[model samples]
Target: MADENAEETYDNFEKQAADQAANLVEQLLAALPEPETRNKPDGGLNPVEAARRQPAPQPGFDGTIASFAVNHDVLVPGLYLSRQDGDIATYDLRLVKPNQGGYFSMAAGHSLEHLLATWLRSSAYGRQVVYVGPMGCRTGFYILLRGMKQAAAVSLIREALQAAAAYNGAVPGTASTAECGHVAEHDPAGARQLAETAAALLKDWTAADLVYPA
Candidate 1:
């Protein structure tokens, strides 16, 4: 009887081992690749090689005063400050969007413009609010300076970014009749994100010589 009991125990162990092996095989088959396969290696082209062959997009115009012709019929070269009554010493921040066939809407760019301008003017660096508006080509904005020193805009940009990061104030001109285009209420979070990106870009900008007509 002891020998028969030992034989039964061995049989049980062998059955369990066989069951486990079958389960493992089933799992392996489930994880195996499908029979259908593509003939092309790497789906046709190598991603790294394709990327290396791709041409990069061209850069936008730098809007420098020197790029324009200064013929007698052309306007004199000077910085035009935004929203100023009569200031010839600064560059004007012109709104170049919202026109027919423009890329960005006037409403969207206007809100960001208002937030940036208001923040710059009210913050500790309010004095550096030279120009703040969109570009005509709907690509990006332009900032003209009373002086060529990049340091002039740096402080204000820093203050503005910190404020935006901790933004609590309403976007100016959104509710009042003085509204430029749109309000920051539409997307406060998105506005802050955009401000952070702009701040990062501004950090890399270096000041160059401010050349004016003599």
Candidate 2:
């Protein structure tokens, strides 16, 4: 009876959390500005005028990328807080050690991206997840979360990776060309292997380990 009661309480908590997250998202969407309505005197946008009004492009990838300043030579395989903007926090899920030749293959990274995103979006904190994608460096991936505690984010990543590692079915969002642009490049086996490796590496990870090694 106690176990049953505990399960019931936990279910209620999860439901409430989901409902609150949904309400917040609805409010944010409602607050977003409507599509640009500016038009030229002729009732059509002028490409030349629009181009002139745009901000000048930076030399290369902006002058202030926090990740670029990170010393990759000393960076190890672990989770690190990349940056924070307003309510969102970007996390670096480093799967492979930096400057090592053990980088994930293209197929492996692509497959893992699909698997990780799918599993994460279906987790308890799914509503907090802003985005999930592979890093250009091929050493790891990035996950953006909104208003999440560091401990909860760490827990979410660990559990999601464990789930991905054990996953044995059709990779989500890769059923056909209609679903994915590069459908032929997925490798479930390779993705699972990567997930397994990452899961083990983060088995004991905690919020305290979130900082980049100095």
Candidate 3:
């Protein structure tokens, strides 16, 4: 009887989670701004064309750091460019709160990583994708984009959080005996906790002193 009750509860949770995910996607789509349309003058160059014509000189401070420091820290988290290199950009996504213990069970982080990578690669904004992987410190994940002001990737972040909220469900690519190799397997409980924290952060994130390249 106890087992049966537990199974029933899990099923109900799955249903509720699916409904919530759909609602969140709707809200995000509604909040997105309409894209602007510009008429190109016959002789005037488009931004891309202008860029092609300019000499490949050193980038400004913000652009320089954003382009080269994929493996290095740019003092801030969310987004940054490396001052030393102008081609690398980074997207820092924290998986655990700072005050909380930094240790994430390997299973938990790895599982969450898989889910996030899958979602981001397939998201509408995937074209901007560069790299998606866990941070070396195990406290968070890093997503590198190909260009500056790559705010479009934030939508993928939102979708990842929604997917994380459905942690109880089976994670794709998680059950491979040969693939996982027992290197700290994925933990759904930990993934759910991290996901919730990330979701709250995203909702509250604003253009205050918190972001980079002010």
Which candidate number maximizes TM-score? 2
Model 1 poorest 10 in a row by lDDT: 75-84
- 1-214 in candidate 3: lDDT tens per residue? 9999999999999999999999999999999976444564434566897678887877575454442434334333342222213544566675554344665777777777777777767776577667777766676777776643544456557567877776577776766676555634667777777777677667645424234442
Let me know the TM-score candidate 1 reaches against the reference structure.
Answer: 0.42
Instruction: Report lDDT (CA) for all predictions.
Output: 0.53, 0.90, 0.64
Which runs in model 2 stand beyond 4 Å of their true positions? Answer: 1-62
Decreasing lDDT order of the candidates = 2, 3, 1
Residue range 59-98, candidate 1, lDDT tens digits = 7876544324422233232222222234313432222222
Counting clashing residue pairs in each candidate, in order, gives: 7, 0, 15
Best by lDDT: 2
- Compose the digit string of candidate 2's lDDT tens values, residues 148-203: 99999998998989999999999898999999989999889999999999999999
Query: Which residues of candidate 3, in runs, are more than 4 Å off?
Result: 1-88, 97-100, 181-184, 207-214
Question: Could you give the candidate ranking by TM-score, starting with the highest?
Answer: 2, 3, 1
Judged by lDDT against the true structure, how good is candidate 2? Answer: 0.90
State, as a TM-score between 0 and 1, how close model 2 is to the true structure.
0.71
Clashing pairs in 1: 79-90, 79-91, 80-90, 80-91, 80-92, 81-91, 81-92
